[model samples]
Structures are given as structure tokens and as C-alpha cells.
Target: MFKYAWICKNPDLKGMARRAILQAMDTKPYSTWLEIDLGAIKNNIKQLKAMTGTRLMAVIKANAYGHGVLTVAKAAEQAGASWLGVARMEEALNLRAAGIKSEVMVLGYTSPVM
Candidate 1:
């Protein structure tokens, strides 16, 4: 089990992120869980963008390293990610199905027959 609190400097963003985490916990009680601070993810993306002075491609493969792909992807996009990277076409499709409009790239090999 993991627990965390929203510590973003932006008050509005902090509130939204905190609510999202709390909602997730509420929906999945009594199960092993990892509490991801979405606010931290957003802040890190923003910082990286500032440091690089270029657009960023957020790699959200493997359920965002087990942090919930959809949630992390949305937060990254909101924080100015220009693209999303995944390991498979199915992951990309799942993102699209969830209404993620960010440009996506499948980094893994695909069978020609598919």
C-alpha cells in the first residue's frame, strides 16, 4: 500500500489532483493500491518542459509504470505534454478510447498480420 498527499504549488491544480486521488481510493477500498500524486506528475512535466525548452513526449507504457495510464496521461497532457508513448498498439488504442487526443507512438514491434 502507498499513500501520498497533493503538494503542488498551484492551489487549483492541487485541489483537483487531491480529489482525483481520493476518488480512486474511495472506489477501490480493501485492495492493494499505489497512491500516485498526480499533482507531482504534472509539476514534473512542467519543470521538464521548462528545462528542455521543447515539447515533451510522456512515456506512459505499462499503465504508466503501474501508476494508471489513463490518469497519468491526462495529467501529463494537461501539463503540456505534446505526445504519449506506449509499448503496444493496444495501449495506444486504450488511450484513444479514453478520449486522449495527444499524439501517440507505439514503441514496440507489431506483427504484420495484425
Candidate 2:
């Protein structure tokens, strides 16, 4: 199995590259994946609101714990999450790209020197 790691000229190709990598990985002895249910997330958020009676904030850091950050954030927003938490600026940027208007907080460390 070949581990392909390369930067593409077109940024949008990254997802395609990821798929190719996964397909290549299928030949490996071990692999992993996570299945996320947006319906479940919405239901859970509703339950939290009912129990706490307070606005809920969702932490989607670490690529939403490997559950696709954009999908989770959108569901969370629709489910009444006032804010989304991310550990990297890239994650926040991705949320913005997805047209998410909810506030996104970056919990990762930043350098002032830049």
C-alpha cells in the first residue's frame, strides 16, 4: 500500500485526495471511521435545551471528533446552538465557508506575533 501525501494545485481536490487515500487504505489491515447522525444531534440538543432551559453551545473541535465538522455545525445551528467551538482557525474558516452564521470560538492557542 502506498501512502499518498501531496498538495494539489486546486484546493478543492483535497477531498478527492482524501477519498483516494481512504480507498488505498482499504487494502490495509486496519482502518477506522465514524458515523454521525444529525437527527440524533438535533434531538440531543433539544433535550439539553429542555433540561437546562439555557442556550446551548456545541464544541466541534478535532474535526467534530472525526464526524465531519461542517455537517455537525449546520445541524447544531439548526437545533438552536448559539455558538460553535473549534480548536483551530481552519475549522472556523470551514464553518464560515459553509455559510454558518453562528458564532465560532477558536479554543486553540494563537500567536500575537503574526
Candidate 3:
């Protein structure tokens, strides 16, 4: 069995209601998993672009920190990121294969043998 709990010092009623609904939903038991809000990523990217007033790069290295590189990269690009940064040539190649058109920078060294 899985237990879900939300503890907050100042709880908003609406937020509590939402949390209750989420807890009621069926989910498989897993030792670990990730729940990513892609909309939040996009919104944050937009906010950063607005604040910086300069081109921004969305680093999707390490599979976007395990949040799915392709999805995160697309959201970041759509939200006005001028470039995507990856840690390796393979990661950049994967993005290109996925039809990601944004400019990509591999911040790590690539082996000549590859």
C-alpha cells in the first residue's frame, strides 16, 4: 500500500482539494518516479527570458535531469529559449534526430573516435 500525505502550515482550501483528488487517483507502486510539470517549465523559461533580456539556453543534459530531454527541450524552445545545451555529442544528436531545430551546444568534449 502507498500512503500520501500533504503537510502545510498554511493550507489553501483549493490546494488541499486538488491534493485530495490527486491522492485518490490510482497509481502503480514504485520505489522512485518523477512527476514533471511541463507547463511550469515553459512558464519559468518565459519568465527567465523576460528577466534576462538576452538569449537563453535550455540545458537538457542528463536527459533534462531525468525529466525527458525531448519534451523539456521542446517546451523550452517554444517558450523562447534560443539554444539547447547538452553534455555530450550523443545527447545533441538525439535532440537533432527528434527534429529539435534550436541551436545546440555540447558543453563537453566529444571523442574523435566516435
Top candidate by lDDT: 1
Residue 38 miss distance in model 2 (angstroms): 1.3
Candidate 2 weakest ten by summed lDDT: 26-35
Assess the local accuracy of residue 101 in candidate 3 as a C-alpha lDDT between 0 and 100: 97
Put down candidate 1 lDDT per residue, 1-114, tens digits, no spaces.
Answer: 458866678999988987787787775556686789999999999999999999999999999998889999999999999999999999999999999999999999988987
Prediction 2 global C-alpha lDDT? 0.87
| Candidate 3, 1-114: lDDT as tens digits | 555566666669658866777777758687986789989999999999899899999998999988899989999989989999999999999999999999999999988897
Give the per-residue Cα lDDT of candidate 2 at 25.
72
lDDT of each: 0.93, 0.87, 0.90
Question: What is the Cα-based lDDT of residue 35 in candidate 1?
Answer: 82
Off by over 4 Å in 3: 1-29, 112-114
Q: Sorted on lDDT, highest at the top, how do the candidates line up?
A: 1, 3, 2
TM-score of 3: 0.70
With candidate 2 superimposed using the best TM-score fit, by how many Å does residue 7's alpha carbon deviate from the native?
27
Q: Tell me, what's the RMSD of every candidate? A: 16.6, 10.1, 12.8
What's the CA error at residue 12 for candidate 2, in Å? 43
lDDT string for model 2 (6-36, tens) is 7778877988888877876775565676677
Worst 10 residues of 1 by lDDT: 25-34
Kindly provide the TM-score of model 1 when superposed on the true structure, using C-alpha atoms. 0.69
